[model samples]
Target: MIQRLNVNTEVLSTYIRNSNTPIEYLRQKLPNIDKFLKGELEPTFNQVYALSKLINIPTGLLLLKEPISASSLNVDFRTFNSELLSDISSELKDTIIEMQEKQEFLKEIVENECPFVGIFTFDDDYSDVILKAKELLGNEITRKRFDNYRKILGQLGIFIFLNGKYKDNTHRPLNLNEFRGFVLSDKKAPIIFINQLDSKTGQFFTLIHEFVHLLYGDSDLFDGEDSKKRSKTEAIINSITAEILVPKELISDMFDNQIDIRTSLDSLSRKFEVSKFVILRRLYDLSMLSRKDFMSLQNELEAEFKLIENIKKNSGGGNYHNNLLFRMDSNFFNHVNNAVQQNKITYTDAFGIVGVGYKGYKILSRGG
Candidate 1:
């Protein structure tokens, strides 16, 4: 006899309502999904487990006594109190759940606390924070600015994952508008995720912002665009991030009001190794650019950024192993491998933690 489970059809329906996954694709994975959704058939244990893994939600959610929500209100967009954070696209939720599960596992075996975590309070002077950031930089290496930052951050115990899509699922691309990046804060294994879908320099700027969030030892979701919902913490983090990216004193010394605004934006971006928008925003914050002029230039820059991103997206990627480093945290990768070697975690367990199978893991180990 097949053991059937009483799955909440209402909750299942709500979860799949706005899912980016096509209904036909889901049917391929769980052929009885239509019946399950309609309450025509209670799914079996195997069916519930298959649905959980496919949708990136916990299996226990399917067994809930009642739907988590009283109604579908705000289930589509709002962030919820649950750690599962189920309302987002499976891609985003999957990535979050994967990184976090690995972090939790690492905490058991890793003993060292990162000195930089919780180094400063939110109210602390940003100028002082910049000095601390510079201290972390030590001797500045002249290179691609963000690449240098990514290297040092990983070495310093902050794991960096930069990607425009979810894992290697090319079909499921990330949306920067919904979220630019997020930080998962841990003293020993903090994680920084950048949605590379943003403009090139915009990604770097977000890296800095998420780094700041890590310093506070707090997990935060960042939306880089201007919004009515931005909090005091976000405002402070942005201010500090902007100042750190393009220091006021440095800009004041180099900026020439007589230079054409367009020319100045280009020059300053190159000089500071930041995006044109960052340069413009810093200038605007300094009252160096008129509100009317800033608004006009901002729209122009946004369009240019989008066009460049589209062109790059069309012409991107071939090296798979090389990409494993950017998409998965290298330091964490080694630690997971080490655990596998000691029999602390099985190869299967390692695969689940890193979100890859045997062949992919082999490729990643070559590049880890």
Candidate 2:
């Protein structure tokens, strides 16, 4: 005689919607899940727990009388191309939840010392915002590359995260069409999450774009091109971001130095240390390049990108520890390690948040 509990089907339904978990996946992960979901049959405790894990929700939450909706830490940023996002993938939603969980834990321990956060608004002139942020960043954005900017952001007490999969679950890779980056602004533990699956250049541009969201003290989910369409707030932040990456006067000056449009683009790319995509975007935005030509140039670049990806794919994935370290910001990782040392959080807690075991965590602690 097996005992089972009548879990709240309504709660389960709400969670499934929030998670975007596929019905087929649930069916495959749990036999007779349909009956459990339909309340036709009570779920065994084990079944309920398994279902909870499958949906990436806490097992106990299934018993709640009403479901508390997750914020997803983002406003519903709509665009003309909203049709493209018929649904946010479960994997991406899960990734956001994981990041928010880490932030929730870290906020209690982190210092709310960064002064640049929540300092700007869309009403302010974009140029003024760029001027102020650059004054503080002071050449970090100029001489700095991606990794350098990452460290600087960490120093500013922002949580930086980049991963192609959900919670290191390789089975669930993020979709770039859904979002290129996300940011949730906070006085303490502000978060910047980039989709590592995007082209290295794409990620770079997205980084600054999300930083703008952080500065405005707002939350955003940014998808390149799609996000640039019609949102007024997005437009202001993007305008600021363009200036931060490649100042109008500077790009204009640099543009005059080259001969052939194609040849000069490469030269400008090297000069600015930004991606050709970014250079083209800046040029197009400034009315320096035509959209048709820009699209043509971008297609050529995309073809080159595909070739590079295949070559890299043929090679093995890089060292696990290095990848893990790359995915988690040193700024955030150090706090976790320090918390362990201060006995504020157990190694177990650190390990869980960092998605590492004892050996991997030790390597991270040693600054690997």
Global lDDT of each candidate: 0.71, 0.71
Worst 10 residues of 1 by lDDT: 73-82
For this target, which candidate reaches the highest lDDT against the unseen true structure?
A: 1
Off by over 4 Å in 2: 1-86, 140-144, 221-230, 310-313
For model 2, residues 20-41, the per-residue Cα lDDT tens digits are 9999999898878888778899
Pairs of colliding residues, candidate 1: none
lDDT of 1: 0.71
**Which ten contiguous residues of candidate 2 have the minimum total lDDT?**
73-82
lDDT of 2 at 345: 58
lDDT of 1 by residue, 1-368 (tens): 44465667877876666345678989998888999999899876446646766776654455544544323211111121111222356566656655655665565556788998988886687777778877785435355888888888877888888777776677888766566677878897788877767666777887888888777776753233224334556667778778777878889999999989899999889977888878998999999999999999999987997798688779856577776666677778888899789876678667766777888899878884
- The predictions' CA RMSDs to the true structure, in order, are 9.3, 9.1
Error of 2 at 48 (Å): 19
Q: How accurate is candidate 2 locally (lDDT)?
A: 0.71
Which candidate's TM-score is highest? 2
Clashes of each: 0, 0
